[model samples]
Target: MGSGSFSSVLKKPETTSFIILVLVMVGFTLANDRFLSPLNISNLLAFMPELGIIALGMTLLLTAGEFDLSVGAVFALTPVSTLLMVQNGGLSLELALVIAFAATFLVGALNGFLVTKVGISSFLVTLSMLLIVRGTTLVLTQGFPLNSWDGDNWLRTALAGSFYIGTVRIYASLIWFAALGLLALYVLNVAKVGNWITAIGSNRSAAVARGVPADKVKIWLFIATSMLAGLAGVISSLRIASASPVAGSQYELEVIAMVVVGGTALTGGRGTIIGTIIGVLMLRIIRNGIVLVGVPGLAFNIFVGVIILAMLVLHARFNKSSERK
Candidate 1:
């Protein structure tokens, strides 16, 4: 009976992901003592929230049977717009932020409109957006970094400011990630809309037959996702005091990997906020660990690619086995 219980526990995808995360942490710590050092840990925590904020939204979209390929471009584009307005357009910072976020919301609304109303596949719609937004960002900046953040504002500091706890430094972005993650957790597990999202992902026809407002829910979700991505970008720009045209390039795949490896299904219908958080830590630790172990920084993607492939295969098998049972 104990063995059977253990077997059942092992069958859970989130449990499997947690085990892998622990193994990686152990392996890295063994490889380099600094892996456990407070300084390295501080640096790792500092890098967590921007990517994390984006991933939280991606988790929701994926769980609702959708994807947003333009999030990466939006991550770059939103901040670029805000900075350009502040630096060159003579707009007040507060007004610039309001306009930038409003534009972000519109981008998501457009993607949702094309997918839900115009009958386009989410992939094709978002892929086209990815190119368009990325191109616009590059053309606006002419491929240069915008370093015109001349003065600090309370808003910037509130979003990404640094503070110390004993010897370790922390950022306000971490607080944002935590608060938003908890809200996402509630959305996935507690709310009526959560059930609606899962129902739509699991079986759209059935959900609609049962009176779920599939299109509206998905459209609102897209808007929320875009807002999250844009917010992360703003936080990152504030932290670094610069907006780079090329920032967040290729981040879509990485964020997806974090969701998938964290035990979210590629097919939608199921996912876990806690698991996704663990997945975020796993990848971040892996990146930090690889550098400590003397691996070339440029080859980090090699590790991520391999992990994504492995997880996809494992999950497919796991899902198939559950079906057979």
Candidate 2:
């Protein structure tokens, strides 16, 4: 490791986050010898992708000076909707999925419309959406888990199949996570959309005055976030071989925390996809470490809170320093 890299890597936020991730890995591995075990590592990989995918979407939304609290609701609603359409409405699995995603897209569009066209705050708009989507899901399922269809299909296999790497099983979701992460990275760093997002978040009035389509971009970002959440929901349901209206509870908070910890400014206009990926891994590793160390499950949230607070403090400090320079 020559430590020779681009100037961007020398920036404090990304550098510090990468350091913290390495330290967390080493410390957790030392604390629990099995933290590095293949089985546990494999399990973590299997489950982490769903959240990682959602966090990538959150990264984009936050960078655009907006957020989607309804993503968790979308994650829960989409898969359950698919299952219901297939099982109760007698639709093919593919058609059921299409309908479910269309519904999710409408939720996103509604959120965007309320925020942009109706002049509502994004937070309040998404919060209302959260309630609406979750309520609809509960009304449909009545708090019962939807049974996954047992028939073999290419969709299920493509979304959630596993492969062997000698003795370890590599999940399809992980591949999706990586692919989506890379795509997000390109969009955020290389595409014209990235510039539009950064400009809108940095200064909405100025961006609008300068001819950037602020409202349109924000609405599109909302749609993208919701669609990504839907995909995550599908992957999760397929992996577990079932769908539940209660899935993805508290996931909005988790994804936000991951994005913040990964060096994305909560205030918007700044983000790093690599840092977001590291943040996702860091949170998952901590949860896994807590379990391996025999800590009471009740204390898990407490640990997460402390870590999030500490990361925010560090990020804020580094941000100030960067401004000074």
Candidate 3:
């Protein structure tokens, strides 16, 4: 490929994402006049931290050429674990949070182990994990929401509650999301581990030959993804002041979609935290716009499906053009 072709291939992802973002914003704004308002933007920002956190991990995982279908279950299970610890075990909120995060990390480690050591596809392993974790949540909750935790105030105030800046109320998770985004950007763009991650995602065998410790990288990605999911779950529970078994149902799809739509290649080796952030914002805004326009919630899924398909088609076209050159 000539220099022009090489540069075009490199620029395609960013260009496509930018186009999609503009279209989403314009379409939604046209659908609902309030979609571009500060309040609606703020609400969309609130939606971002949870999915954004997960997508950060998911982006890493995807860049490493793996998927974690179990994230939704882990997300749901984290809050369940915290609630169980606080309600029946009488554990302090801090302790419960620690235990919950530890459990998620373990789940992630197991996922990495199964995929790398046992040679199982991440899809199968994480799907099985999804069922297992969801079942465990059901068993623990006995199919009921646990509203009995007594330490809601501290937990709520620390992570989920709104922080006021003059007349504006910002969700605390937003700060966490921004911090995580910057951290992820630094890791993926500047850190040694980030280079290893991208190398492994690009070619596992090549990365291994270069002493990248591919398995360890995969394992760490799994742990990171799960830990973020766990944190999101806990913060979400604190925000709501209760834990429900179904609290994060289908979250994996949403997070994965956000990452993929943001220009992360499922086949691996190319993605950006910034692009994923924009993708999350686009999805959240669309969802919020749907409600504002009186569209049924069910229709939001259709919209997401359409967006994902469009992104995939664009990705494929970009690759084909590059290959042709």
TM-score attained by model 3: 0.92
Could you tell me every candidate's TM-score relative to the true structure?
A: 0.95, 0.96, 0.92
- Candidate numbers, best TM-score first, in rank order: 2, 1, 3
Best candidate, TM-score: 2
Comparing 2 and 3 by lDDT, which wins? 2
lDDT for each residue of candidate 3 in 1-325, tens digit (9 for 90 to 100): 6998878756667568777788878877888888767677677766679889999999999999999999888888998998798788988878887888888989999999999999999999999999999999999999899975556466577689886665456899999999999999999989999998899999899999988899989998999999999899887777777889987889999898888878888888986888798778767866777788787877877876787788878877887777743
**RMSD in order of candidates:** 1.8, 2.0, 2.6
**Clash totals for all candidate models:** 0, 0, 0
lDDT of 1 at 285: 89
CA lDDT of each prediction against the hidden true structure = 0.89, 0.90, 0.85
Candidate 2 residue-wise lDDT, 60-134, digit = tens: 989988999999999999999998888889999899999999998899888988899999999999999999999
Off by over 4 Å in 1: 1-9, 297-299
For model 1, how does the per-residue alpha-carbon lDDT over 180-282 read when each residue is reduced to its tens digit?
A: 9999999999999999998898899999999999999999989998999999999998888889988999888878888988889878898788889988998
| Greater-TM-score candidate between 2 and 3 | 2
